[model samples]
Target: MSYRHTLTAFILAAVITPGAHAQSFDPGSMKTPDGQPDISGTFTFRTLTPFQRPQALADKVALDTEEAAQFEASERIRLNRDLFDPESG
Candidate 1:
C-alpha cells in the first residue's frame, strides 16, 4: 500500500505485461486479411545473396566498393531467368 511498493509493482507489471502475451510473426508465410497467404513485397529484384555471410567472406566483415560491385553483379546473374534451367520452369 506504500507509495514505493505500489510504484515498484506498477513499473514491474508495465515492463512484464506486454511480454506475457507476446505475438510472434513468422515472415516465411505471412498472410493476408482474407486468410490467403500474402506473397507480395515492395521490392521485385529478389537477390540470391546468402542470409548468412558466405564462408569465402567469413574473414572479411565488410566489402570494399570494388568487391561490393562484384558481389552485386554475381547476384544479378544468379537471379537471371536466362541463366536458370529451362526444363525446371
Candidate 2:
C-alpha cells in the first residue's frame, strides 16, 4: 500500500511540474506588424550634461557653448597626452 502511494505521488508530481513553471516566448512582443524590430523613439541615454562636476571646475557653475567645447577639448588632450609617447610607461 505504501509503495503504491509513493508511485502515485511521483507520477502526479512529474505530470504537474512542467506546465506549472512553463513560460512561452512571444517573438512579436517587440516587433511591428511589418516584421521589423520596433525601435522608434529618441532616447536621451547619453546626454552632454555632466553628472558631477570635478573639484577643479568647482567655482564655475556653468559654461557657455564655446567654453564647454574648449573645456572638453583640453580635457581630452590632457588625458590622451601619453598616447603616442613610446617612453610613457
Candidate 3:
C-alpha cells in the first residue's frame, strides 16, 4: 500500500510540473491606467560621435562641411589604395 501511494504521488507531480514553466512579458501590450503607455524611465542615447574630435580636426569642436568632405575623401583613398594596385606578373 505504501509503494502504491508513492507511485501515485510521483505520477501526479510529473503531470503538474509542465504547467509551472515561466512566461515571457510583452512590453508593447502593457499600459498605464490612464491609457498612455508608461515611458518615464532613464534611457541611454548613443552616437557615432568620437569622444574627441579627431586630431585631423586640429582643435575644432566639430567638422565643417568642407572639413568633413576632405576627411571622408582621405579615408576612402586610404582604404582603396590597395585595390587600385596593378596586377603583379
Cα TM-score per model: 0.38, 0.32, 0.33
**Per-residue accuracy of model 2 over 1-89 as CA lDDT, tens digit each:** 99999999999999998977676567688798888998888866245445678787899878889989988766665666767453743
Q: For model 3, where is the 10-residue window of minimal lDDT?
A: 43-52
Best by lDDT: 1
Q: Which residue segments of model 2 deviate by more than 4 Å?
A: 1-52, 84-89
Off by over 4 Å in 3: 1-53, 85-89
| Higher-ranked by TM-score: 1 or 2 | 1
Looking at model 1, residue 5 earns an lDDT score of 100
What is the C-alpha local distance difference test score of candidate 2? 0.76
The digit string of per-residue lDDT tens for model 1 on 1-89 reads 69999999999999998887685556655778777888787864465667789787899978999999888777676667587665863
Instruction: Please state the error at residue 59 of candidate 3 in Å.
Output: 0.7
Worst 10 residues of 1 by lDDT: 42-51
